[model samples]
Target: MLRRSGLQALQALLELARHGQQWSSVSAIATAQELPAPMLEQLLLQLRRAELVESRRGRQGGYRLSRAPEAIPVAEVLDAVGAPLQLSEGPAEGSDGRAETQVLQSMGQRLQNAIERELKQLTLQELLFDLESWKEYLSNEGGLMLG
Candidate 1:
């Protein structure tokens, strides 16, 4: 349930990680991921401010990861982009105070907590690894079917 900007930020970071310390222009990442360049540019600036990404200015200058991908957690990226992990807010004011409402609110809070915990544990490197594995699996399956 990530906002578009949050998803774009993750995609941009993954692209940077794939390049392995190489500088990547906004246009390059935008084109590769089919994202809007202007939006991506702003997201990178936010990431830079968050200290998750480093940028340089020059002919060969662009953006790169500020630290190793393994050090950057998915929750950190979402937070940097202002995307809250919680899907909904707590109970509304002036409620009937029924047991059902209380139960539902408690369950919702528990779910949000679990999601936050998982996102914190997931690193950018792990995301990249999963993406690579999925691609490889699809390619292998395609080849087998064709052969």
Candidate 2:
């Protein structure tokens, strides 16, 4: 699962994509996505540094996607927000140098790699489509029911 910042960044990006190449103010995005403006601004700064989004100054200035939605991968967005998917480091301390430990470590690394590969193939455009589908489904279902 994504951290709060990563989720917020994705939401903000989706909002921008929905608007096409038009620049969107931080406040506008925050309000639309229900994210905190201050934190969203910081996340946008990180994204700008990563070159995932571009920003402009002045009264009519704000931020917009640096590339088309299809060109920006979900992995790239997570990376830009400093939330790269990764498994926790090696086994716990004080563990004996056992073959089982090594096997588990290798498996963990392989799993992480597979996750990264899938994420790389998933772009913002795809996610946006999925998001819309989910919204429609939920609405048709009269929202989700929790036990």
Give one digit per residue, the lDDT tens place, for model 1 in 1-147. Answer: 788888999999999999988999999999999999999999999999999999999999999999999999999999999985666676673277798888887788789899999999999999998878766668846522221
Sequence-dependent TM-score of model 2: 0.86
For TM-score, the strongest prediction is 1
TM-score on alpha carbons, each prediction? 0.91, 0.86
Instruction: Give the best candidate by lDDT.
Output: 1
Candidate 1 segments whose C-alpha is farther than 4 A from its true place: 90-94, 140-147
Looking at candidate 2, the ten consecutive residues that score lowest on lDDT are: 138-147
> Candidate 2, overall lDDT?
0.88
lDDT of 1 at 2: 81
Root-mean-square deviation per candidate: 3.4, 3.9
Error of 2 at 30 (Å): 0.5
TM-score of 1: 0.91
Give the whole-model CA lDDT for all candidates, comma-separated: 0.90, 0.88
